[model samples]
Target: MNVEYKRKFTAVVTALALVGIGVVLLGRDRVNAAGSGSITGTVKLTGTPPHMRGIDMSKDPYCVKQHENNPAKMENVVVSSDGGLQNVVLYISEGLSAGEVSAVPSEEPTVDQHNCMYSPHVVAMDVSQKFKVTTSDQTTHNIHPLPAPGSGNIGWNKSQPPGAPPIETNWKAPEAISVKCNIHPWMHGWQVVVKGPYAVTDEKGNFTIKNIPPGSYTVTAWQEEYGTQTAKVTVAAGQPGKADFTFKAK
Candidate 1:
């Protein structure tokens, strides 16, 4: 073959490879609600469960009506007496582009104080996002942040009363911030200050994140008591990948 022809052939091959990679990357991230990848699996326990502590189901005036005499299970804090899993935070680790990120901040995410309980146990929001702290019931509640972890947190306090205007606050921290009501000590919840979109698992230990770009990622699962767990996952075009997490109580 002629030298010029050989060089031209090599150039075409390299261009095709590059295009193929780009197509693959694009295909992976375009599934549904966002993309073509998937992350689904179970989060099971790994060790001895931690004895329940610091939770008073009886403390929340609103809970007594629903769970009489039963020890209050902290929201999203899964406890399996048979060594089951708890608190898993699975997320995409790689093959994602911030340019196409859809986990945008809502103009208003309401956090209501009802029956002295924080409605959503785990709330996810973007940094610098606006979220309302409102009270729907007659009780007075305060949103207390447990100092942003790793940012040398100085517990910040805000008071919200029923009939009063909602408090507009920006989450300046990058990590998850634990919020509680000092007045109602048993009132507990969490705010996930995420850069992108995320969700917390429910009581049955199930989670699903949609619209991920197909590729490899390190999905992370986190629990208040169990710390953080991560696993490697690969997603294909228009397909959901099963990515489960496990956390054994220590």
Candidate 2:
């Protein structure tokens, strides 16, 4: 073969080799993301569930009208028929690497006030991750978040009129902040801030925190009324770990 052709062939071979290496590295990254373990469990409540007080919205005709036929009740303690608890925040409280702890989500989480109630009732978000608070009700509403002292999060109260733009905000520290609507005193919710992945229990009390790196972790479950319960969990690559918790009745 000609020297010129030989040189071109060698260059093409080197380029293909580089491309193959890039592909392999990309695959490894994809595998690392997809192969990470998860934490899944059920949060249950022991003993009889507390009675949820029904809210008297007659003071506000708008709120009353919203729940005209169906009355609204406090959600401090919501337990399923089988003793499963709902709206519990489950997250890795400790043992996460710096990379996992600092992995703030790009998309902002949202809390919406609709029909005189906070949608989802509970939200779990990463610290420093911005989140949105919006009102969808026709009536004016106030967003008041009371973060615990020393939690590094400042408490704020703001009013959001109907159709107002969403309020974007973030928590500087990790804490479970109690959120309420000052206008509608009965409206209540929680914002659970954490440094790593977290999950909220569903109606059936099931929660799953995904993409957790393999390690032993201190998993905690926090409830608005029951406080917090914790358990130790060990996660392995491509496998799920269990950390069930049971809160006792008061």
Candidate 3:
């Protein structure tokens, strides 16, 4: 090969190698960004779980029909067969700075009333994020959310008739608000207001809070009936953290 052609070929090969290196570095950055660490654990009941009281929907014919074949039970404390506690809200109660905290999701989280019961017994969301309250029941229902005073969240009451549009709202502060249906005294649920990422335990009592920036944090698990428990957790980038909790039955 001519000297000039050989020089050009070497330069082209070097440029190609540099481009490949750049591509690999870019991919690594993308992976690191997408590989934020997560916290996961299971909540268990250390003692005997209380028996859930049976709910009576005889007053409202619609509710009665909705649960005629499958009666509903109080969800104050839901326990799995293996003693795992369900519906517990697990969240990073502290340690995130303003910049590290995620912004409120544009999409609203929903609390659905279905079959004379709240679809999810417990719901959690970031403060100031839009929230939706909806009902699929044929009966007219009044939703009353009672946030504790001094929590900076204003409490409100509104009626949602059958097929009514979802009620959009937001909590200005962080608080675990209790929600109830005045029309159906037995209907109850919780709206957990938080400043950062949170998770609710499933029927199996497992929970996972994802996309958390690496840091030392105070993780809390809250149960409507059993109260709240806290634990310290240290998370590293691209590594999973574990924070298990156990609530003793009262």
Off by over 4 Å in 2: 1-35
Residue-level lDDT of model 1, residues 62-114, one tens digit each, is 54554455555555455555444544455554556875443564656667776
Counted clashes in each candidate structure: 22, 0, 0
lDDT by residue for model 2 over 116-184, one digit each (tens)? 999878988999999999888889999999998887889999999999999998999988899988788
- For all predicted structures, in order, the TM-scores are 0.69, 0.87, 0.87
Clash-forming residue pairs, model 2: none
Error of 3 at 78 (Å): 0.5
Estimate the overall C-alpha local distance difference test score of candidate 1: 0.66
Estimate the TM-score for candidate 3.
0.87
lDDT sort, best first? 2, 3, 1
Please report how far candidate 3 places residue 227 from its true position, in Å. 1.4
**RMSD after CA superposition, every candidate:** 7.6, 3.7, 3.0
